[model samples]
Target: MFDFIKTQVIGVTTPTVDFIPTAEDLPAFCARVSNPDNQKNFDTAAGLLKYCMRVGHWSVFDMSNIVIEIEAPRDIARQVLRHSSIKFQEFSQRYAVAQNFVIREARLQDTKNRQNSIDTENNYLQEAWKLKQEQVLNLVRENYQWALDSGIAKECARVILPEGNTMSYMYANGTVRQWITYLKVRDDLGVTQKEHVDLARKIKPAIIAHFPFLEELMEK
Candidate 1:
């Protein structure tokens, strides 16, 4: 039963975001910005919010609150931890056993630049690389499970898992200002891990939905 529970929780690819506002919910936030003090000091005219965001009056943008969670590979999660703005809660292998690993078709190593990669469109190479990863992952999982069954501590047993393991990452209560900072860096084309870039793109819509002004920032 515990194995089933663990498998069901960890073995999924679809990223889940909770409580992001729908189209109907956006007007309330607009209204809040239009009349922050109930005195209607500002005319609440068209393009007001965009102008504020452009000129760096981020206080109004700070009022927008959105919470999202991401399930990402451990390699990508490490890069994400560099963003100090967003609060995070992540799955701890020290406390719990890992149930899944992230395995992807290996990219061709870029010969021109040691830090870069090229697309591996060759089917034969892709298949061989994937098979190799799966075989290694199976061995790792088998050994990890044996350690657990033999009464080894989870904290110590987890050392056997590789950096590409899957983890549930929860990012809580990010404001518009912080979201802009996060997306700007992580969404860059030069980011080391493809997983980080992909996850950032996936989460972009939720931020744009609530804070359309951020769309301009994204374009930059």
Candidate 2:
């Protein structure tokens, strides 16, 4: 059962960001170059970055980039792909067989907001859902394997798998500005799928560790 979320920062424009200026200071540097009067100093760079974010000058943040490898369900991966600005390459089910599935405790659908779900205390419902989910997933896996054994093309055989029946590895690349925007919608907005919210939570710390300056920008 693939009941875990995994995220890794595969690449970054700068490995370390500090007060001293270098390529790591691209966002602040871009902001600085926008005006002839700005001086070269750590304080100035830091101030410029903050000012840019404060005044909605998001373009400056596009100077730096981050690449992340995320392991999640196909459904959650689709959600991440909704941010069109971020580029992505996902594990292709058409080319390879699915090895695992994402199964989790089922939640009651939110009536007030169709896009949301709420945790329920009904043990019987939860147990029944778990049993049905497992049965369906196992049956599909067996069918997929049988199809492959019968020489059916993976591309055609993959059609029987449900969205949650596949675990996808997605490599996503985006500018710091885009990452911030994506996280804001998925993490801070309180409207995203719970699984995606959890995935974003894992990704945020990795980015922050590399670019400490982005910490505040990612928050509400």
lDDT, candidate 2, 62-120, per-residue tens: 88889999998888888899999999999998898888786677788888888889988
For model 1, how does the per-residue alpha-carbon lDDT over 13-73 read when each residue is reduced to its tens digit? 1113333233222332454555566423233422566666677776655555567777676
lDDT of 2: 0.81
Clashing pairs in 2: none
Error of 1 at 195 (Å): 1.6
- Candidate 1: where are CA atoms >4 Å away? 1-46, 112-115
Candidate number achieving the greatest lDDT relative to the actual structure:
2
Report lDDT (CA) for all predictions: 0.63, 0.81
Q: Model 1 reaches what TM-score against the true structure?
A: 0.76
Candidate 2 positional error at 37, Å:
7.9
RMSD of candidate 1 to the true fold?
A: 7.4
